[model samples]
Target: MSGKITQSNNFIYTALALIALLISASLVNVMPEGILEYIIEGFTLLTFGVCILSLRFDKAWTRFMVSIIICWLAATLLYRLFAIEMLDYLILVLMMVFFWGTFRSIARQILFVGDVDTNKVIGSIVLFLLIGLIWSIIYILIIVVSPQAFNGVDGGPWRHNLSQLTYFSFVTLTTLGYGDISPRTPFAQVMVYMEAIAGVFYMAIVVASLVSAGLSQTKNSRE
Candidate 1:
């Protein structure tokens, strides 16, 4: 049972990291624009599918939340494929809720787990990437609501906009101000600072939690 659990955890973390890589690649501008969008969509769907499958549902509520995520994914894809502009806003709202739920679920699992094993370490990394993705989604939402939210982003479809924003998200999360992308609006500026702070605090908390878990495991072994 333990081996199976570890395998499942490894698969999910791998998928998460792969999705982040795909997004990063999309930002490099080397790939043909049309093909990159398709690749990103495919990988995103695959990542979400893996996340849903690998999630450890400990209660009825979590199971229900998973179902909701499935429905959100389906709706978002449909709207994107059909180019339904009005409904795309609704999709953004759903995406925010889904991402928040996912972050909460994963954070809870990591914080409450009894052992500081490889799985937990991988989970911590996944959580960090998830935070970046969540902030990216928020940046997208800001752009959607206000066209002037940010500067230096190319004018194109929403898919194209995400490529740049996703890159900017991780950059800001790591406190690496590349100066390539800047927030034009006050709200966007505030969000940028907030994400920076969140990134710092999250790292500090994860390190402390891991150290605590490791000490507890060592004490138990000595006993």
Candidate 2:
């Protein structure tokens, strides 16, 4: 809310998100076995778009968020229909960009919103926590309902369920692992660990940087 956003940056992000959606759709129900990267790949680009939107949420915040949802929906439909290896790899690149943009957005929000009106700040915090909590709870419920199918992880009964996969993804994202469900395959382990590291860095480096910077500035101004 404090800084100005360039239209060029927004258009770039929108373009990437849109392409990711279209590519993801093309692979629907068409990917080969042992390759479930399509979903991740699709979401990686889509989420990057969301992260970008977070930064420059000016007059078009609502519309931008809606567009993100539409992209996700399109991706989901595509993954269900076809699968593609190349597209999955492309998603990896998207994830890299997404992580960077996500942390940047968080840092900026923490910095800019600190000086805003109390009610508005509090409302934003509550809204963020609420949406995050609701999403996690529903995800956990789905995992609990069909643990076997989800935990199977080998095109078994849980291929469609995706509970275990989703669970691990969040666990790694939040850097919380209860040890009940873990990555069995080497590739899975690598993915989860990478996510955990990314989460840690985001919190420690970006979030902490914003908070500490604010504190230092406030202290200096008082002096």
Candidate 3:
């Protein structure tokens, strides 16, 4: 049981590391654009790999999802290397599934557990980051379907657009509207508003849950 807990903690740490790397890459302008994008892509792949490892599922389901993720990752890489237009859609879909599964697993672990521990706290943070990632993919999908969904985002390679969308997603998630990236379409605006609400609600729920869990643990110890 202790070993299992340690593995879970490691998963959260890995996710946090990936989030930091992605944000750092986005903010740093010293590197050439192409090289920066390549680094970001590398981190993206690594994130997917870590997410797969972090997934908590029954054996059959685990095997199935892992197989699908592996196939999608391979196809996404091949299409990206060839500059295929499908790469954006592929990655968008892949991230949606990945974030959904990861969020569900982490939420379950944190909410259902009886004890409050470091892993639960870390999982809460991971959940927050995962929410931002999910919104980023949603933003990308909107842009893919309608290129004019956002203002201040230039029409360019999807990779560049993805990086920008990611930054925008986190900014929106944190409710730190810098006024630089605004949604032009109603659909985009709706998503941005939803993400902002989700960010607030998620934080509130996690704090409540953690506090309740901690109190329960203390009471149980006394009994």
Candidate closest to the true structure, highest TM-score: 3
- Rank by TM-score, highest first: 3, 1, 2
Q: 34-114 in candidate 1: lDDT tens per residue?
A: 677566656665665556656645465457667766776777678767977766666556656756666787788787457
lDDT of 1 at 39: 66
User: Quick one: best lDDT, which candidate?
Assistant: 3
lDDT of 3 by residue, 1-223 (tens): 3334255475565466667656655743566666765676677677766665666443444565676678677866787689677775676687678677777766776874668877667778788877887888788788878889999887666656666888899899989999999999999999999999998898789888988998999999999
Q: Tens-digit lDDT track for model 2 on 1-223?
A: 2333343234334434434543453353466754645464445445455445644564444454445445545644565567653333233333333333343344345443444333323323322322232233333334434433234443432233233454455565677777766655454456556666755654565455446656776887799
Q: How accurate is candidate 1 locally (lDDT)?
A: 0.73
Q: Relative to the true structure, how large is the alpha-carbon lDDT of every model?
A: 0.73, 0.45, 0.74
TM-scores of the candidates are: 0.84, 0.40, 0.85
List candidate 3 segments past 4 Å from native.
1-5, 24-29, 56-61, 80-82
lDDT of 1 at 183: 96
lDDT of 2: 0.45
